[model samples]
Target: MDVLYFAWVRERIGLPKEKVESQAATVNDLVAELSAREDRYAAAFADLSALRVALDQELSDFDASLAGVREVAFFPPMTGG
Candidate 1:
């Protein structure tokens, strides 16, 4: 799976995207795995409530299923100007 980081997430993780071989079946599981990897991922995912996620390019929730998914992106919730 390709995990993507946006804005401050990219800053925290030090990358915009990366390919991951994960056994995680859900978004939360993936997050847990990523967060456990290092401090960078932990910080990036610190406040899950403040984030918005996209699965396979479709906006979704943190608890969404990852079945047959090829991409997962994390970013802060967008605000209208």
Candidate 2:
């Protein structure tokens, strides 16, 4: 899967995107795996409420299944002026 990070998430993880190999069944599971990898990943995924997720370019919940998903994007909730 191609994992993408945006805004502060990109800053924390130090990458815009990366291909990930995992056995995670859900978005939350993927997050736990990444968080266990390093401090940067932990910091970026520390508070799930502060962030939003997209699966294959569509908004999704953290508990959403990752089956057949080719892309996952993480970013903070957007605000418009």
Candidate 3:
């Protein structure tokens, strides 16, 4: 799956996108896997509450299944003025 990080998450993880090989079933499971990889990943995924996830460009919950999903994006909730 191609994982994309935006805004502060991109800053924390260093790169904006990467193709990740994961056995994770759900978004939360992926988060746990990433968080275990390094300090940067841990920091980027520190607080799930402050972040939002999108599966193939559609907003989704963290517990959502990743099956058949090609793209997973991690970013803070958007705000508009």
Candidate 4:
């Protein structure tokens, strides 16, 4: 899957996007796997409540299924000016 990071998430993970190979069934599972990989990933996913997720560009939740998903993006919630 292609995992993308935006805003501060890219800053923390040090990459805007990367291909990931995993057996995760859900978004939260993927997060746990990444968080276990390094301190940077852990910091990037420190608070799920502070972040938002997208599956193939569609807004999704951490518990959302990853079936047939080709892309996943993580970013902070947007604010209106």
Candidate 5:
């Protein structure tokens, strides 16, 4: 899957996106896997409440299924003025 990070998530991870190979069944599982890989990933996903997720561009929850999903994006909740 292609994992994408936006805004502060990207800043923390030090990259915009990357292809990941995993056996995760949900977004949260994927996060745990990434978080185990490094401190940067841990920091990026430290607080799930501070972030939002998308599966193939559609908004999804951390517990959402990852089956058949080709892309996953993580970013902070948006704000408008």
Candidate 6:
């Protein structure tokens, strides 16, 4: 799957996107896997509540299924003035 990072997430992870080989069943599972990889990943995914996820370009929750998903994007909630 291609995991994309936006805004500060990209800053923390130091990448805009990357192809990931994961056996995760849900978004949360993927997060845990990434968080365990290194300190940077851990810091990037430290607070789930502060982040928002998108699956294949559609807004999704952390517990959403990852089956058949090709792309996953992580970013902070948007705000409009």
The models' CA-based lDDT, in order, is: 0.92, 0.97, 0.97, 0.98, 0.97, 0.97
> How do all the candidates rank in terms of lDDT, highest first?
4, 2, 5, 6, 3, 1
Give one digit per residue, the lDDT tens place, for model 3 in 1-81: 999999999999999999999989999999999999999999989899999999999999999999999999999999869
lDDT (tens digit, per residue) of candidate 4 on 24-58: 99999999999999999999999999999999999
TM-score to true structure, per model: 0.94, 0.96, 0.96, 0.96, 0.97, 0.96
User: Which regions in candidate 4 have their CA more than 4 angstroms from the true location?
Assistant: none
**CA RMSD of all predictions:** 1.0, 0.9, 0.8, 0.9, 0.9, 0.9
Model 2, 17-67: lDDT tens digits are: 999999999999999999999999999999999999999999999999999
Model 3 weakest lDDT span, ten residues long: 41-50
Which is the winner by lDDT between candidate 2 and candidate 6?
2
Off by over 4 Å in 3: none
lDDT of candidate 3 at residue 18, scale 0 to 100 = 100
lDDT of 3: 0.97
Residue-level lDDT for 81 in candidate 1: 100
lDDT of 5 by residue, 38-60 (tens): 99999999999999999999999
Worst 10 residues of 5 by lDDT: 72-81
- Clash pairs for candidate 3: none
Model 1 spans with C-alpha error above 4 angstroms: none
TM-score of 5: 0.97
**What's the residue-level lDDT of 64 in candidate 2?**
99
